[model samples]
Target: MTIHAVIFDFGGVLFDWSPHHLYRKLISDDHERQWFLDNICTQAWNTEQDAGRSLAEGTRSLIEQHPQHEHLIQAYYDRWHEMLPGPLSDGVAILEALHQADVPLFGLTNWSAETFPYARANYPFLRCFRDIVVSGELKLIKPDAAIYHASLRQVRAHLPDIQPEEVVFIDDVAGNIEAAMALGWQGIHHVSAQRTAARLRELGVGF
Candidate 1:
């Protein structure tokens, strides 16, 4: 089927975000920092917040579990802004090109609702999307069919006639792309702006 719209994943794709951006300064020792990230501020733990656990609640629960690392745990969200340096310029350029071409755009991201507002305020390019389906707001996350269905609903709100096969989803995670493909949407596992752009071009997207 012909691609009619594009859905973007925020972090790692368009936005440069990583806990190491903040933890590197806090834990100068490379091994120690890696340990903290691997054990303390784990991706699985952070994904809980992305899946709708409130920052306050998740922080308090984690601190309770690891009282010794209270300060570091609190710092995860308190200084969360440090994790995001800025947008990935190359990907943003592609988005701008697609916008200029008048293709419908949407965002489907596994981001915490509380922190998403900060990103929205800082990134002016987010306005390019007609709508964004945030996982935290919906209590869902990527690699799960539910969120993709929710995203399709959001897309259909603006494009009443769009079909599942006519939309392309871009994400940095392989699992997320696989899930999208399983749901009948074209999936692009975005490694770089160049590759993503090439894939879009192959799909007959002018931009």
Candidate 2:
């Protein structure tokens, strides 16, 4: 089927987000930075927040578990905006191009509900998506069938006739792309704007 809609992953795909950015500023020593990320605020630990644990709840829990990192734990949520450097210009360009072409746009992301408002307030391009399914709001993360299906359902609710094959899901994460592919939605492992444009062209989405 001809691709009808585009679903984008927010952080890695459109924006550059890494705790390292914030932590690098907070913890000058690389070793200590790495240690804090691994032991105190791990990817897994952050995922809990993404999976719907309130930032306040998550931070409180972590601080309780690691009293030594209380200040740092509080910093994760307090300084959350520091982690994002802003949207990747290349991806933003593609999103604008797609929007200009009138392609139906949607977002499926695994981001903390508490922190997402900061993005909505700061980034204008996020408004390009017709609708977005946030994992934190739904308590489901990507690579899970639930989030994928939820995204599709949201799209269909409006369009009412879009097929799974008619949706192209783009993300920087391989696992999320793989999951979309398994669901019969076309998946593009976005690396750069030129590459993503080439992939979109191959799929017959006119710029």
| Candidate 2 lDDT over residue span 1-207, tens digit each | 598899988887789999999998889999999999999999999999999999888888899999988988899889988999888888899999999999999999999888888899999998888998989999999889999999999999879999999999999989999999999999999888788899999999988
Give the local distance difference test score of model 2.
Answer: 0.91
- Predicted structure 1, TM vs. truth: 0.99
* Per-candidate clash tally: 0, 0
By lDDT, who's the top model here?
Answer: 1
Worst 10-residue lDDT window for candidate 2 reads 6-15
Q: Quantify all predictions' global Cα lDDT against the true fold.
A: 0.95, 0.91
Off by over 4 Å in 1: none
